[model samples]
Target: MIYLDNAATTWPKPNQVTEAVAKSMKYYGANPGRSGHKMAIRTSEKVYECRELVADFFGLSNPANVVFTQNSTMALNFAIHGILKAGDHAICTVMDHNSVLRPLFAKSPDVDVSYLGADSEGVIDPSELEALIRPNTRLVAMTHVSNVCGTVTPVEDIAKVCRQHGILFLLDASQSAGIIDIDMQQMKIDLLAAPGHKALYGPMGTGLLCINTDFELAPIMQGGTGSYSKELTQPLELPDRLESGTLNLPGICGLAEGIRYINRIGIANIREHEAKLTAYLLDGLSRIKDINIIGKKNTLGRTGVVSFTHNSKDCVDISSYLSSNFSIATRSMYHCAYKAHEALGTSDGGTVRVSLGVFNTLSEIKILLYALKNMM
Candidate 1:
């Protein structure tokens, strides 16, 4: 099968990641940080090692600032719900996913929100953000890349604006984490969230939130952190303050191996491979009659995701045809970003999305292009 839905969740995770999960489940099954037993201590050490690896990967100096979650959605929830309080103001963009939008919606009348608009190509101007900032604007949360069209945001420029205004910047790195080299320190990002299952190639149910040491957010969930057990309230430390209940040990172990795999292969090589495939796919799609390619037509300032719609054929029908007839896996519909679809003028039936991964090859692209051409 030719899989092209890496933007949702990666497939065929590295052998190292799978083996690490199995090893954690088979040997180190004890609850991390729950007790003083040797097994528990060992599990805790493994978890901390993964923390250190993630911290180093993202250029964070303190390992303790890394907090694990079930997925990027959860991490985003913790950041959004925790940071925005009553009477506070926050800013986001139309390119953001529902993970960023829904939480801000939940805040409702208690907190004020300003949405930045994106051009038809899903590109935003950093200069537009300065005018949106209010004295009460506390945070600006946005995605590093558009999940719908793989449009890369100008994060460094946006971060600079946020820093100059003394507003916090929260980045949702769900699509760009492992593929793009993101230096949280150099970028001056106040908070960063990413899923381990997407570009990181880790098992599902694994994500992380990296926080700058100076910023403090309120805890959304309060429970036992295995630290400060005597105190009735949650611990005020870095991770334990945010992390409640037993952590996902096996998932964290696998995530650590995934990060190691990325380090071994080098992210630049992965980016180059995906870019080649994306450009090829875009060229092929553009050649097909009555097809409209969404977002930028080229590889400039974008990741490997490509979305398009045919004039007559329904996007779901095209995706179903590829899956049933050609065994090609692709995504259709809003991609959970309705605002993006509306902004791009494809809200009627959404678009067919072909997102490439590291394991995909030029031959697979050829087959996909042939299938699409024949379908047309």
Candidate 2:
């Protein structure tokens, strides 16, 4: 089957990722850091190894600042809810997923949320963010990349604005984590969240939230962190403060290998390949008589994800046609990013999304184009 829904989750994870997870479960699946046994110690080491890799990959100076979570949604929730509180104000863009939007929405009337608008191309001006900063503004939540439109937000510039305003910067790097170059320290990002399953090519049920040491937020959940066990209250440590319960040791083991794989291949090479594929997709889709590409009409400053809708055609019908007839897999409907669809006027049924992965070849693009053409 042709898989084009990688924006949802990457398929066919790297061999190293699978091997590492299996090895962890087989050799040292004991509850990490919960016991002094050799197996538990080994599990603890393996989990820490992943933390170190994630810290290094994102340019975090310390691994302790990284906390493990179930997925980007959980990480995002921790950041948005942990930081914004009563009488405080936060800012986010319309392009953000419900992960950011819903949490902030719950805080409405108490914690003010000012939304910055994105254009038809799904680009938000960095300067506009400064205007949204109110005196009570405590944080600026931004998506590193738009999941629906694949529009890359200008985070560095936005970070600069947040810095100038003394507001904490929260970045949802769900779509660009392993695929994009992000220096958390250099970018002045206060809280960064991402899923290891997507571009990282790790197994599902793994995510990371890297918090800058200088920044502090209350724990969202309370439970055992395998540290300060004798104490009744949760530890006020960097990771233990946020991460409660047992770590996903096997998943973290695989995630470490996934980061290693990305490093070995180099992000630049991976991005270049995706760029070519995105360009091909855009140009070809443009030529189709009844097709209308979403967001930027070109590949400039976007990820490999391309969302398009047929003129006067329902996206679900198109997706079903492709899947049943050509064995193609595409994401239809809101893509879990309603604000982006509402901004682009695709809110009814949204657009058919094709997200290319590192393993996707030019031939796959040709087949997808052929299938799309036949739909008309």
For 140-170, candidate 1 gives per-residue lDDT tens digits of: 9999999999999999999999998899999
Best by lDDT: 1
Off by over 4 Å in 2: none
TM-score of each: 0.99, 0.98
> CA lDDT of each candidate?
0.94, 0.90
Counted clashes in each candidate structure: 0, 0
How far out, in Å, is residue 236 in model 2?
0.5
Clashing pairs in 2: none
Poorly placed runs, candidate 1 (over 4 Å): none
What's the lDDT for residue 169 in model 2?
Answer: 94
| Candidate 1 deviation (Cα RMSD) | 0.8
